[model samples]
Each structure stands twice: as C-alpha cells, then as structure tokens.
Target: MLKMTKPREDETRTSAKKAGVITLTGQLAKALVQLAGLIAFSHLLTPRDVGLIGMVAVFLLLGELIRDFGLSQAAIQTAELSHGQASNLFWTNALVGLVMSASLFVAAPAVADLYNEPALSSIAPWIAVTFTINALQMQFQVRLARDFRFLTLTLTDVFSQLAGLVLGLIAALLGAAYWALVVQLLVASATLLVLRAGTARWVPGAPRREAGMSALYMFGLHSGLAQLVQYVASNADSFTIGIRWGAAPLGIYNRAFQIFSAPANQLLAPLTNVALPILSRQRHEGRDFYPLLLKAQIAISAALTFVFAVVGSLSEPLVRLALGSAWRESAPLLSILSIGGAAQALSFMAYWAFLASGNARQLFLHSLVTKPILAVAIVLGSVWGLTGVAWGFSLGLVVSWFISLGWLAKCDGMPARVFLSAGLYVLQSGLVTGAVLWLLNSKFGDHAPSVVILSIGFLAGGAIYATLLCLRKSNRTVFRSVLSPVAARVKPLLQRN
Candidate 1:
C-alpha cells in the first residue's frame, strides 16, 4: 500500500486527471463499438427479438450485482490490504459468482414464464454465465485501477468490446437472431476476463482467516446491498416496462434508454474508475477531495450533457439515422430520458464520494432512501404507459440528485456548490442548444436527410455551447481547465502531424 501527504496534492491531482483522460478515451472507443452494434442489430433484429433478450437482461443484471459483492470498490477504498485478504475476497467472489450463475440457470424457466416469452429459456442460461466470467476478474481489474494503470485498463476495455461486437455481428448475420445478443455479451465478458487475467496476473492463494476479514465483510455487505439497490433504482424502469408493456416496446425503450444513458455511462462513468483510488487516498489523508470531484462533474455536464441535449432535441432524425425509420417511437423516449441522464451524470460523484470515505453505511442508507423514491416514481409513471415511464424515470433521477446532495451535506465539502458551479450553467447551455436544434429539427427533420440533421446539430450545438462559454470570463476559465486533458492529447498529435 502507498501513503500520501498533504504536500503532494498537485502530484496526486495530475495523476488522477491523467488516469481520467486515459479511461475516458477508452470509454469513448467502447461507446463507438456499442453504437455500431446498436445500429447493426436494430437493422438485423426486430424489436421483439431484442426485446426478448431485454427481458432476460433484467434478471441477469441482478445476478451481476450479487457476484462482485462490492469487493472491487472496497479494495479501492481501503488503504491497506494483505495478499491473504485479496485471496479471500477473490475466492468469495468466485463462489458467489458460481452460485449466482447456477441459480439463474435453474430459474430460467420461471423468468421465461414471467415474461411470457419462451425464448428467454434459452437466452437466460448463457447470459447467466457472464456473472462468473466477470466475477473471476473483478479483482484483477481492481488491481490495475488501484495502481492507476489506466492505459492498460483502457486497452482491455476497447479490445474486449471490439471483439464482442465483431463476433456478435457475425452471429447476427448468420441468423442467430437474439442469441447473437447473448453471444455478444458472453464473448465480451470472456474476452475481458482473459485480457484482465493476462494483464493483472496475480494468483490467489487459498482462502484463510485474515486480520481485517470482519471489517472487510461488513464494508462489502453494505456496499454490495447499496449496489443492488442502485441497480434497482437504475433498472426498475426497464423491469417494469418489460413486465407491463411486454417485449416490443420494452426493446425500443431499452435502446432509447441506452442512448440517453450513453453520456453518463460512456462519458462520466469512467471518472469513477479513476477517482476512486485517488479519492480514497485523499479521504485517508484528511485532504479535501471535492475540487477534483467538482471538476469532473463540470467536464461531464458541459460536454456530455450538451451531446445528449442535442440528441434529445433532434432525436427523431438521430433515431432515423441510427436505428432506421421503423423505430421512430424511440425518439420521444430518448428526448424525455435525456433530462434524467444529465442529472445522473452529476450524481456519480456523490455516490463515489461516500465510497471514497469508506462510509458504506451512508452510501447504503442514501440508496435505500433515494432509489426507492426513483423506483416508486417509475412505477407510478408506468401507470400511464411507455411515455409515462420515461417521464417517471427522468424526473425521479433529477429528484434523486437533489436528495443525494442533501444526504451528503455533512460528509464532504458543499456538493450543492458542485451542482451550482458545474451543472447549472450547463443546464442553461443544454436548454439553449436544445431550443436551437428543436427549431431546426421541426422545420426539416421529417423531409431532410438524417445525416444532414445530425451534422448540423453537432456543429451548431457545439458552437453555441462553446460561444456561450466564451461569453463569461469565469466560465471560460473553468471550461479551459476542465478540457485540459483533451487539449494536451490533441496538441501533441497535431504537432506531430
């Protein structure tokens, strides 16, 4: 284990920021591959085909939540860990994963019956295998992250995703139908497992009593349950929509939701990977970690939220271009879901803040309160149907963010200021960008080429946001700092060229 002192704040900041850049680039590459799959699958497979898989996915997501037992986050948050404890956690994860995979396999029939989709019987078992595949490598990836080996992590992520996409596309083209989706997921997990094993080659010793086993277990339990509830909060809408509306609409909802969430997951989620070990160090060292947290929030909100804003505003054309005209129904859903996605981007920091402090209890309690609020919101909104579900999820996420700030008030520096300094201005910029694109979209989206609509949307939205940033000295300074990583990378490449 490594220790840090207050004097090394700048060094620590530089390392964290560099890791973030590497991780985000990797996420960008993976996101592009996922985008390719989304487009290819939408054309090759029907809404019902993907929808059936979506139903099985709802259950598999839970098994995934169970397998890791939150040990990955626990490892990052802890300052000291012996090889014995690492081996213990690894075996525990392997056991949990094996059991979860078997349980899901055995219960596939019940899941199929519940969804009234017979294909789920076949789909659930293979997907279930992913639990063990992913679990076996959880700590390998954690070791890389703890050591800030982000470049390696990035390579692993991109290569695995690319491999999965190519294999899945072949399966789809060969008439695998929904099984192609299953194969895609399995191959991805397996590829990631192989790569991680190769990269972080640490052999686990037999499980034994460790000095801090009790504390580790207690921490992991709360963290794990908190993760489960967090999954429920995030996926409740998918589960509800699939159960209530059936497969066809659920499939569309799933894709639309993925697009809406792309910014948060692809853009901001990687920050958590970079921030955890660093933030844990800061918390351990009695230093304020809120500045880094806030900087990440602003960078995400300004850039990613703006992208989603344009997507929401010009969704019809984007959908038509990406998923084809048959999937127009997803347009409104993506538009509505963007609101929640933007808020969710900022909420990532607060969630990880609790983890960094090793306060799994606070994290768990916060999830218990806010996640239910989200689930209930989605359930109540589902009463009105698919559009209602979208509204419910979006508004619920916004409400959850506000509550999360309040819940974390006594723990860290002012989180509300993170929102105020970061999100509020971006919110204003998103609204403006949305309005401009909506007008352009309203006039020509139906008759114009989608490529044109998207081209103009990207250009105009980005220009508008950038110009607006330049209007204020304070905002310009903030954005310049937030975007330093991209500048650093691009500047070197341009000079070489």
Candidate 2:
C-alpha cells in the first residue's frame, strides 16, 4: 500500500488558503477569457451558429463525463493510493477515453440526423477528439491537485484556455462559423493534456492488477454515475428546447445560461478544488471538518448571492451590453435561472461534504433522488415553452435544495439551522439589492445606456446590500468572516504596488 503522507492541520489550513487564492485568481482569469469569448462570439457568429455548437455540446459534455469515469474524484479523495493502483487507474481512464472517442465519432452522423442538421456530422467528430485529450489530463491533474500544486493547475487552465480562445477567435474571423467553437474546445483539451502532464512529473510504470483496485473502480463507477445523472438533469432544458423548438430558442437560452451559470460555476470550482483535498486529508487524519466546511459555505453563498442579485435584477442591461440588443430576449430567462442558480449553489457545498467524506455510494443515492426533479420540471415546463421551462427548472431545483439539505442533515449531522440562517440572510440581502435595482431600472432603463444602467445598479445595489448586512450583528459577523480573508489577500498586492 502506498500511503500518501497526510498534511498537518495548521499547514493544511495555510495551504488551503494559498490554494484557494491561486485557484480563484486562475478562475478569474479564465472567466475573463470566457467573457471575452462571449462578447466576441456574440458579434462574430449568428445565433444559429452559436446554438449549433451548443447542440453538439451535449455530446461533448457526455464525452467529458465518461472520460475519467469518476476515477479522478475517487483518486483525489482516497485516504491512500498505491503506485500500482494509480498506474492502473491511469490506463483505465485512457482506455475509456479511447472507447468513448471512437463511439462518439461513429455517433456523429446519427447526431446530425437526430437534429436534422447536416452540419453536426462534421462538428461532432472534432469534438470527439477532446474526449481522449481531456482523459489524459485527468490523472495528471489529480496528481497536481493532491499535492496542492494549484499554481501549476491554475497556470495550465488559464494559458491553455487563452490559446484556445485566440485560435477560436481567429477561426471565427476567418468565417469558421460554429467550427470556431469546436476548435476552441479541442485546442484547450490538447493544451491542457500537454501542460498538465508535463508539470505532474510522475510517470506510470505499468497497469498491474492490485488488491485495492476493485474498490477504487467501484467508487469511480458510483461517482461517475452520480455526476452523469446530475449533468443530464441540469442540461435537460437545453436538450428539450433544441429538439422541440429547434436551435433559435435554444440559442437564446444557451446564451442566458452561459452568462448566468458559467461564471458562477467557475467561481465555485476553485473552492471545491481547494476544499476537497484539504477536507479529505482532514478525514484521513480524523480531524474536525465542520469548521472548514462552514467557512467554505459562507464564502460560496455570499459571493453567489451578490452575483445573482446583480445579474437577476439587472438582467436587461447585462444581456444587452454583453450579447447586444439581438440577445435582449434572454433577459427574462437569465432572471429565472438566477433563482435556480442560488438554489443549486446552496446544495453545492453538501457535494464537497459527500466527496471529502468518501461517501460515493451515498452521494450517488442522493443524486438519484434529487437530480430527477429538475429533469421532470424541465419536461413539464416545456408545456409553456421557454418561459415555462425556466420556471420549472428554478422551482424544481428549489425543491431539490430543500430535500438535499434534509438529506445532508441525516448523513453528516450538518448544522442545518446554521447553514439555513446564513443562506437566508444572504438571500434577503440579494432581495434588497434586487429591489433597489428594480427601482433604478424602472426610472431610467429605457433612456439610459446599458453601461449607465449597470453603473447605477452597482453603486445603488451594493450600498443597499452593505447596509443590510450592517443592520444586524449576526449579519455583520457573516460579512467580516467572508470578506476579511479577501481583504487580507488584496492588501498585500496593494502594498507591492
């Protein structure tokens, strides 16, 4: 048995913060790249062109889900992993990626036929290549993450993504249409595989059978299935919209989704990356994890609340400015999706808990129970078209959030009251900001430029949120807890300047 040495609590705490800062900075850079792409693509490509890539994205996402087959998660969270086990897992990931890539290549024509769009036949094959590229990246990334080498992880993410975006932007300029999007995804994957593998340094000796390999495989199986179910649930709306109403509506919804949810996901990702490995180490060391867990939850809810507040309340101006007036139709969808985003955000930390605790089977069971609610809601929502679907997605997820909290309480003995109070406090503050933005928008929205409208929303809504937090002592504590670390980090950069 190759038992990786556990980190001490104090050292782990310090490293976790450094990891968080590094990863967050990286995600911020990546978000900018995405924002730039969103702006550039909005101008360069037609809505149908964007939506066509989105249509193939379902398969691309499926390829991603299958590539590592949950082994990455299993590997990261394990208390101990043998070198032989690791090598075998790497080979297993490579084989799965190869199989999925070939399968997707064969399925391309059928995918095009399913969409009744001949263009997809070509697009899907290139996207199939990303599956294998990304699969090779998995074990390498897991190794870096296990060692808390987040600086390398972050650099690889940002630089490779920048390269992809540059190439994609060039392709679009040269009239590649939807192919530009495919090129971006492919280049990013290949770049990540190269850079991450180069930095991870460790090499697999051989894929020899080991005693503990079966348990790890089982863990991967369960974790991968759980993630697949959740992915399908979250994306049910896109599939339904694309199939029933075709690409136009799907295009609009996709834009809204990217704007509202993509940034939030990027923000949440660093937290998980930093928190899970630390928490797993804590579990292996038999230390208390709730303190760290609560801090992470507080940070997540506070950040998400502020973001969703601005996006939801100022949906019109945000969509207009980012996507131009052609996409103003997405504003309502963005607003509705904001509610669901918050609901999902609340449950997200619970996910880290499940993973850190190494409860893959339990997590899988929980997902089975909760994830279908969103899928069902999306289906029922299509009865009313896009608007109905948005509401269904939101309301269903809210239901799932409530159920998820209850489940976590049962499983982890989580302090539900504390979590709920913090979430509620954040939610109310968001509501206040929303109200402030609503009055601001109603007064000058029609006459004002989008930039002007957003500027006013930021100042007015930010002041209102700050005031609400200061009104109560408990809320003030929450504010300090979430912001002090951020302030501490920023102060040093200012000093250096």
Candidate 3:
C-alpha cells in the first residue's frame, strides 16, 4: 500500500494540517460572503429583476461550461506536468475564451430575443466580456488546486468574494438594476487576475509546444467532456424551468435551490478538491485507497446529510425568518432539492474513485449517460411546474447513484454489497432524521418555538445515528480506523461536550 512510509516530520505534518484548517476557514468565509450577497441582492432587487439576471445567468452558465475545456482538471490530474505544457494550455484557453466571449457578445441580441427581454440586449454583451478576463486566470487557479496549495487558494477566495460582496452592494446602492450582474462578473474576473498574479509560480510565454501538449490535450478532452456533461445535467433544471415557467417562477426556484445547494457547493467542494489531488497521488500504489476513499465518503456524507436533513425539514421557518414571507414559497423546493443534493454528495465522492484510478473516460461516460436521463426528467417534470421540476431533479440524482455505483464497484475491485451496506447506514440515518424532523415540524407546524425545539431534536438524531453506527460491526470497524489517529485529541472534546 502507498502509505506515508516516511513519517511526516513536525513541520510537514503541521503544514498538511494547515491545508484542511485553512480550507475550512476559506469555505466559511466564502459562504458568509455569499449569504450576505444573497440577502443584499434579494433586498435590493425584485424577483423580476433577479429573474431577468437569471435568464442571462443561464447563458453565462453555459459559457462557463464551454470555458471549462478541463484544462484545470488536466493540469491537476497530470502526475508530471511541465512548464511548456502549462504555458501551452494557458494560451489555448485564453484564445478559446476570447473567441467564446466575442461570440457571446455578438449573440446577445439573439439571447435577449429568445426570452423576449429587450433589456437583455445590452446586459448580455457586458456579461460576456467577463468570460474573456476569466479565461486569462483559469490555468493559474488550476495549478494551485493541483498542488493543494490551498493557503494560496484561500487568500484568493477571501479577496475575491470580498470584492464581489463590496461591488454587488455598491451596485445595489446605486440602483444599477441589471448592473448588479456586471458588478458580480467584473469582480470575479478582476479577482482571478489578482489571484493569478499573486499565486502562479510560472507564467506562460510563447510556446515551443512539445509532446506534453498532446498529452495535456488528451487529458483535457476527456476531462472537459465529462465536466461539460456534468454541468449540463446539473443545470438541466434551470434551462427547463426557464423555458416553461419564464423568469419569475424560475427565479424563485433557482433561489431556493441555491440556498439548499450552497453548503454543498461551498463547503463540501473543498473536501473533494482536497480528496481528488490526494487520491490521484495515491492512485497507483494504495491497496488501501479504495477502502480509505469509502470511509472518507461515509463520514463526510453522513455529516452533510445530518445537517441538510435538519435544515431541509425546518427550512420553512428558517426561510420565513431569514428571507421573510415572500420567500416562504421556496421552503418546499428547498426540501426537495436537499434530497437531490444528498444523492449528488454520494456520487461526487464515488466519482473520486474513478478520478484516482486515472479513468477520466469512465467518469465522462458515467455523466454522458446520466445527463440525458436527467435532461428527460427535467422535461417531463416541467409539465407540473416548479415543484415537479424539483422532484424530477432529485429523482435524477438517486437514479444516477445506482448506475455510477455499479461502475465504481467494477472498477475498484470492491464488493458492491459491502459498499452498499456501508452507505445503507448513512441512508438509514438520513431517512430517520428526516422522518423525525418532518413529523415534528408537521405536528407543531412552523411556530418559532418549534424551530428551537426541532433544532435540538435534530442534534439528538445525529447523536443517536452516530451511536447506532458505532454499534454496527462494519461502521464500528471504520470508526475505529478513523478514531485511532485522533482519539487522543478528540477525547477531550467529547468529554467536554
């Protein structure tokens, strides 16, 4: 097994530990900024105004898909990336980004016409310009992630999110209306530029492109395709909802989904980001890699599921209190979207196994097949409006897990039953917590006291679930494995609690 053969010295262990600490710190900081942005944006703008931006956002998201030709993944996943290859990718990305941005600029009128929104004609062009600036910094960001140089990443995010928060608030204060869109994109692009300048150790020059370009492109092609498919599937609901329900309803659904997904995208992503590069480094050598990955998945998934289930069940009161009565409509959508997010959380970790095995095509195929099925579900669900769309979106995630798990089992040489059994504990925990919270909420409805009472009950559910897991033979074994290393430090915290 590719274990840490040479024990990490104090300094090295301290450094590696800092990565996780700083990553969490960064995630928390970014989440706070985003939460602030959401509140500020919602207050300053109407649903119609947000919806108008949402329409432009759908196209911008598509632009982001195109922008992600997977240079970042390729750069990160490659075991032996070089200066020349990095330089070549930087230029290639910049060139494509320029072309895409220009096209988007020209196509602004058509996009506006598609939605019959006249104001979009001017707004679309401005938004497209941000893509050009973003392309310039994409490779640099990838380089940092590849190395798990998250201290640098944390700095970039802290500054970037701060910039966006400041600018977005200014735009709102100025009564910029759609100009808030410009503020967001511009700040993001500028932040990338600042981050690139600060973090990148090497800068690209005119390339004397070599064999590395071929290797990098091959890596990028598969990675990009997989990401493209994944992005499309992820955003399928947005596209479908926009088409069927128009901007206002789509805006409401989008906001609700955003709230449910914020923790996942904002918090859980760093875990995957750290996991991927770490797993890739261990890929060829670890006999224990598969088991380690599974264990990590279980722990992280259980934690996230516990948090979300509690929040989802009690989202009605939280939304009303936090966002006010106008957003009460979002409560149901948040609950449904949270279920989908739980499925997504599992698949995201399982897919890391594929990434670690150097199997981008397998990942690509997994999403390629799944995106269509998801897209169809979105279409079918649109007949019933936003609620149908939310349910359909959740259904797709559940279905995708089964399909991807089969492939994961085959490739990893892990027994499917063992893997399922491990996850079953998590599922059982989530279901029980969800059911208890739901019953409690339904009986009491959404009174203010119910929030505090159910919040404590939710915490109790997690404690009960963890105790149950510790009692189970398989989970006990896994927990023991995890506990052995940190038991000393963790014991005090447990005692104090």
Candidate 4:
C-alpha cells in the first residue's frame, strides 16, 4: 500500500474551510458571469440558435468526458503517484483528446444529419477543439485539487469564464449566433489550459511503463466507464428532445433545466470540488469521514432546497424575467424540474464518497444499473413533450437519489438511516417554504409586477426557511460550524487593522 503524509487535523480543517470559501466565491462569480452572458445571449440569439448549440452540447460533453478517461480522478484518489506515472497519464489523456477531437470532426456530418440541421455540421468541429484544450490541462487541474490550491483554481476559473463570456457576447453582437456559444466554450477551455499550465508546478516528462501505473490505469478505466454512463444518463433528455422535438422546443427545455439546476450546479459543484480531495485524504488517513460528509450533505441540501423552492414557486415570473416572454413556455418545465433539484444536489455528495473511498467499480456498477432506468424515464417523459420530459427527468432524479444513497450505505458502511436523517430537515424545510411561497403567490402574485412579486416571495420564503432552520438545534450547529471559520479569519484581519 502507498502511504502519504497527512496534515494535522486542525490544519486540515482550516484548509478545508478556506477552500470552501474560495471555491464558493469563485462559483458565485462564475454564476454571475454566466447569468449575464445568458441574458445577453438570450436576446441576441433565437431559440433555434440556442437549441442548435444545445443539440451539439451533448456530443461535445461526451467527447470531453472520454478525453479525461477518468485519469484525473485516478490521480486524485491514488495516495502516491510517481512523476513517471503522472507523465504517462498526461500523455494518455492528450492522445485520447486528439482522437476524440478528430472523431468528433469526422462525426459532425452524421450529427447534423441526425438532427436534420445543416448548421450543426459546422458547429460540431469547432466545439471539438475544446476537447484537446481540456485534455492537456486535466492533470494540472487534478494536481491543483490534490494540493488544495483552490485560490489558484478559483482565479483560473473566474478569469477564464469572464474571458469566455466577453468573447461570446462580442461574437453575438457581431451576428455569430450559435457560433458565439461555440466560441465561448473554446475560449474558456483554452484560457483554462493556459492558466493551469502557468500556475501548476508539475511538468510532465516522458511516459514510462512504471510498476504502479497499471493500477492507476485500471482505476481510471472503471471510473471513465462510470462517468460515461452517468453523462449519457444525464444528457439523454437533451439528446432525445433534440432529435424528437426539434431545436426550438429543445432550447426552451434546456434553458429551463439550466435555470432549475442553477442552485445545484452553482453551489454544490464548487463544494464537491472542495470536498472530494479532502474526503479522499481523510479516507486515506483512516480518519472518521462520515460526520464531515453528513454536514456537507445537510448544508448543500438545505441551501438547494431553499433556492429551488423559491425558483419553483416563481417559475413563471422567473422564466419570463430571465429569458423573456419568448421562452415563457419554459416556466412549467422549470417548475417540474426544480421539484427534484434538492434530491439531485444531495445525491451529488455520494459521488464524492464513492471516489474518496476508492470504490470506482461500485460506482460503475451503480451507474450501470441506474442510468439505464433514468434514460428510459426520460424517453417515456418525452412522450408528453418538454414538460413531460421535465417531470420524467425529475422522477428519475428522485429515484436515483434513493438508489445512490443505498449504494453509498452498502459500499461505505454508512447507515441508510443516517443518510435519510441528515436530509430530512432540509426536505421538510424546503417543502414548508415552497408551500408558503406557493400560497403567497396564488394570493397576490398578480397584484404586482413580476420583479416585485418575485422579490417579495424570495424575502418571505427566506424568512420562513431561516426561522424553520433556527428552530432546529442540529441545523444551527451546522450553520455555526460553517460560519465560525469565516468569523475567525475576519476578526483577525479587523484586529490587525
């Protein structure tokens, strides 16, 4: 077994706290940039144009996933990795990226043919370039995570997103249409690659057939398979919609899903980035990791529940305000999708647990079994159009959440009851808040402008949720635990000044 140096408990806790703060700030900034870009792009591009890009997104994302081949996860989960092994993995990733890029270029015509969109033929190849850029930076990103260099990671992420948003916006102004979205992705990937290479200390040497490399490769292979299944499962809705319902409706559905999932992707995504490395370290050190995981799930679930509740309650006004009246049809889709956002967010942490515990095979098996069910659900839901699809997708998410928790319990020896108990408070709080907001909206939502009504709903829902959380001792303890670190750092700075 490979052994590694472990940080002191206090230091680890402090680092984790700092990482959380930095990552959350970065994600918030990125979200703002993305939201602004989306608002601008929504006005600049037609629904068909946005939907065209969304159609290609599934393929590009799949290619990106294949490019990584789960090697990044392998690097992070492994306790010890020789420079030779790292170099080998780097080269392997680059090779996969190159091949996938070429494959995407070659497959572009087929994709366009499938969707009967001639423009996609041009769009697919441009998006393929991102795979190469992303592939080259994979190991560097993994190393940054391993070292907990979140500040650097944050800077890279924020700057790249800002750059991409600006470029995309400029392109849209110049009438690039769907190509503007393509430019945004390519620019982001290129910027991230350059920033990562400049900031990361490790440099790849020549690949060597080292002794430990085989295990890493095997781990990555399983992880890659699991990620592939998960990606397909997740994006199947878009794929089916794009093919069956066409671009305009797909665009509306995609945007609604994006709006519905913002809380999970915006908040929990950064948390997961911070959590996995720490959890992996904790597991390696034989530390008790369940409490940390529980706390994280509770906090994320509670926040997601609250946010999604508000969004779901005000789906119509939110959609109209965010995407304009042209996309008003997305309102019901947003509401339906938001129903499972909390469950999906909570289940995301299970991914960390699986990876940290070095259970990629189990992860693969779970995805293998569950993702097909999700795909089927999405297909069945597609029968009802976008709204039906949204409901179906949400149903799948709810089912997947329970299945994921059960798998985590079995694999990690975490009790199912504990997982359920941890999530119960957030679920209840969200339900109550949603009910209150729904009632408020029904009573007086039409009396005011959408902006005013949404503002009132948010404030009222927030107060109710806060009150409910404060009533729970456990929830208060979790809140204080998260806040205490920030307070500690801020107080020192104030005193020094």
* Deviation (Å) of 370 in candidate 2: 1.1
Candidate 4 per-residue lDDT, tens place, 1-497, comes to 22333433342223777778778888898889888987888888888998999999999889989999789889888888778888888999999999999999999999999999999999999999888899999898877777677788888988999999999889999998888998899899899999989988889989777888888988899899999998988998999998887999898987888787766777776666578778878887889788898888877788788888999888888877878999889888888888878788878878788888888999999999888888899889888888778888888888887888889888878766787877877878888998888888788777778898899999989999989877888889999999887798899899999
lDDT of each: 0.82, 0.83, 0.74, 0.85
**Which TM-score value belongs to model 1?**
0.94
Query: All candidates' TM-scores?
Result: 0.94, 0.95, 0.90, 0.95
Per-residue lDDT tens digits for candidate 1, residues 174-229, read 99999898889989999999998898757778998878878888899999999899
Give the better candidate number (1 or 4) by TM-score: 4
Q: Can you rank all candidates by lDDT, best first?
A: 4, 2, 1, 3
Cα deviation of 25, candidate 2, in Å = 1.3
Clashing residue pairs in candidate 1 are none
Summed over model 3, clashes come to 0
lDDT (C-alpha) at residue 414 in model 4? 73
Error of 3 at 328 (Å): 1.4
Candidate 3 TM-score to native: 0.90
For model 3, the superposed segments whose C-alpha errors exceed 4 Å read: 1-18, 286-288, 412-414, 449-454, 473-497
lDDT of 4 at 314: 88
lDDT of 3 by residue, 314-430 (tens): 777667656666767888999888887777778777677776777777878888888788878877887888888888888998888878889877766655566677776787778
Residue 375, model 3, lDDT: 78
Residue-pair clashes per prediction, in order, are 0, 0, 0, 0
